[model samples]
Target: MSDLFSAAADELAAASAPLADRLRPRSLDEVVGQEHLLGPGRPMRVLVESDKLSSVVLWGPPGTGKTTLARLIAGASSAHLEARSAVTSTVKDVREVLAGAQARLGERGRRTILFLDEVHRFNKAQQDALLPAVETGLVILIGATTENPGFSVNSALLSRSVLFRLEPLSDEALVALARRGLVAEGLFSGGDGTTEEGPDAAAKAEFEEALEVLAVAATGDGRHLLTTLEVAISLARSRHGTGVSGEQIVLGIPDVEGAMGAKAVRYGVD
Candidate 1:
């Protein structure tokens, strides 16, 4: 009945959410990789820690942490964040956010951070509509895009914002992330890739080896790595029956390969 369906949906929601979001770093300290921008004494880190951020554009390939960085900045900033996706937002939406930003600044002496995901999706006119607010600092723009802003964003709008490039997660970083993920899921006991001593030793060893292989296969895409890991976990659960999960489950190279090959899962943390 409706009650049964609702219960099923509630159970599946967390399992189905994009891995990047479910395992999202809660604080700047929890974030891995991107040391160049977030390392000690880095200008961006300094600015964010002090909450003195200005209009900036985050440019990077998918799964490189553009959205994550924007959200963190918004949390740390002195401004109110008004997030939107250019893929779904029209000029009217942009105008509304700008108006809210203006009113907020005028009435309460506050600033606003407009974090636009896929800002490159905005057409010339739509991009232009954001210019006045950005230029005048009524809204601190934090535009996230996979495309090059120089080509996709309006020249006028692009010039007003500081551009920060995010690099893809390196293999080492991805491996570290994989280990962290296993720990988070309770598949591994600790960050050292050690099991909790109750799981089968052979199975644990095989799973660890498979994790390395999968990490390399992920090829610098953290979202892909994490999402595929979730799928592999599900496969292990099914293969061994749901009674055994997390630490006691049996997963190996075959599970990873099966998850990768079964279907194309486009869901991710971008």
Candidate 2:
């Protein structure tokens, strides 16, 4: 990792852990959800690979990995990423991020990606603040919202950006993702731990049951799903007075509570 990214990751690890962070996709290939938009030979892949993508609006319900996708793009494009929250950011804040974009463009001839989370929360005035900058190509806007953009965004702003709808992850996808996360953390038996160098059938079955319950509760939201998995991992490590069983694993109180209290928003990209 670059020095700046390493520092940022360290800070996040030290600070309050957000659901997005817990569930954050390690890479594009590992992304748990949004296959419709990001699967092989998809339009989004074409646009992103072309490196000339226009501003886009990611419309979806909560937990669909909107923030994760934005982060992935920012990392891949080498763009100066500026994130703003429609819930808390004023027009002035938007302007400041826009200014950063302008400066980065001038200095590096690189594109700037402004990821707006909960974009539906922005009223007319706030969205208006983005007009001039967007019109002039100072930044590429990536807006995410749980609500419908037509109801939240101004027509002009909506018109300027391409809209990409992200679907909730399927149950199979969520199950696959949980196993992958466990593998990534070396919780599975494929490396150094108690078992052989691969996930055993029993472990796989345990994860399958746990993931099914999580997926159903998460309601297709990859963020919530992953956060639950993270909580389970910590619980397993701590040996917190209880053991995981098929019944206890699924709908575990700890995982459910952790997912609920987690910082649902990280940088307004979700």
Candidate 3:
């Protein structure tokens, strides 16, 4: 009975989570895009694999995998991972994390990796509070920001960390990501819910066109792509009529446009 209830709770939590969060890559192999930083012998991969990472800043537009990379770094290393958003955290919070890191290092010799999301939001004083621990190697700081760190971050703190820039994903990458999301969410047709085989050839063609429309509408952000897909699927499901079955609610271009409140535009040169 307890096991059944636990499983039910887990299912409920997963259903409530955002599709983007649910689909976040679990390992470097599963991660799409950012090939330059994650490819063979890349500096980021080397740092994570060797667990010799130093303080670093990841600068990128929203949904470009800054937080994902930071989490990957912590998972690859033996360090205890701590996460905080600079938008909500204060100087006191920084001091607390540093104190905890100091204690862990002194007592258990365990390193702590601090993943500070939106680090550019931190004011100069709050950032200053983190300098001592970062400098002394008590904590490995992985700061992520959509803003330009060089302009938003304190020069002193910026100087202490290596910076990596992440670019917007390409259109092909966005299409692949949307397709993966469709399969993961079990919205795809066919018996297995993974294959694209639909009830008819027309449905399959519509599904493919819908995926393309979503890929273009996403505008290079993986999170946006997945979110749009999720909403489009839900909208399609809600409008199911007598002929429409659960498995027959495959998305179409109209559904994609309706969910996004705009038509898909051409992405690349003809």
Candidate 4:
């Protein structure tokens, strides 16, 4: 009975998760955008494949996959992963992680990766707490920051780490992401209505046109693109009413415009 309850709770949690999270790519291959970082022979791809990453920083704009990439790359390595947010973490937190990492290294010959998100928020003293562990390889620091590290990071710490700049996603990448978002929302049909066997001709055309509008508004941010789609999907269900079994909910331009507060003028007559 407890096991069944546990499974039910897990299912409830997954059902309530945000669409963008639910849509997160499972493998590096499924990941969209960042081809420059993950392409064949790219530095990141090489490091992940070889499990040889050192202390490094990922610099990128919002929604460009900083946190996602950090988790993916670290998961590929053999080291134990510990994540903390600079926004809420303190010098004490940093010191504790470092000490634990030291103990782990001594006892098991294992490494720990401290993935510090929004690392620019860490003050000088908090960062200082990490320097020794980072320098000695007691912990591999994977710092992610939206701000320029040269200006925000300590000069000494910055020098010891590799920095990779992640660019805003391209238009093509955003489009692909929006399509995946559609499938995740179960909008086109029960199955992913992407190919010829998916949605009918007219429905697919409307879906493509609506996605194009979102791509323009997304401004190379995948998160923004997907959030809008999720809202639009909600608006569609609300507008159509519920309990309409087996009827595919179509997400069209008007639905997107409503979600985005876009005026009818934004998209001229068909």
Model 4 clash tally? 0
Question: Per-model C-alpha lDDT, please?
Answer: 0.81, 0.71, 0.84, 0.83
- Each candidate's TM vs. the true structure? 0.85, 0.75, 0.88, 0.90
Which candidate comes out best when scored by TM-score? 4
* Model 3 Cα lDDT, one tens digit per residue, 75-184: 98999999999999988888889889889999999999999999999998998899888888888899999998889998888889999999898888887888777677
Best-to-worst order by TM-score is: 4, 3, 1, 2
RMSD of 1: 5.9
For model 1, what is the C-alpha lDDT against the true structure?
0.81
Clashing pairs in 2: 63-221, 117-268, 190-197, 190-198
lDDT of 2 by residue, 1-270 (tens): 599999998887855665446546667777776767788988777677667768889888887778878877777776778887888999889888887788788888977889998888988889899988888788888999888888878899999999999887798777666665665455652223325343356654544455566666677877666777777766655543356332222223344335456423221122
Error of 1 at 252 (Å): 1.2
Tens-digit per-residue lDDT, 120-168, candidate 4: 9999999888988888888899999999999999988898898999999
Best first by lDDT, ranked: 3, 4, 1, 2
Worst 10 residues of 2 by lDDT: 261-270
Residue 140, model 4: Cα distance from true site in angstroms: 0.7
2 or 3: which has the higher lDDT?
A: 3
Model 4, runs deviating above 4 Å: 1-4, 189-204, 241-247, 264-270
The clash count of every prediction, one per candidate, is 0, 4, 0, 0
Which of candidates 1 and 4 reaches a greater TM-score? Answer: 4
Judge candidate 3 against the unseen true structure and give its global Cα lDDT, from 0 to 1. 0.84
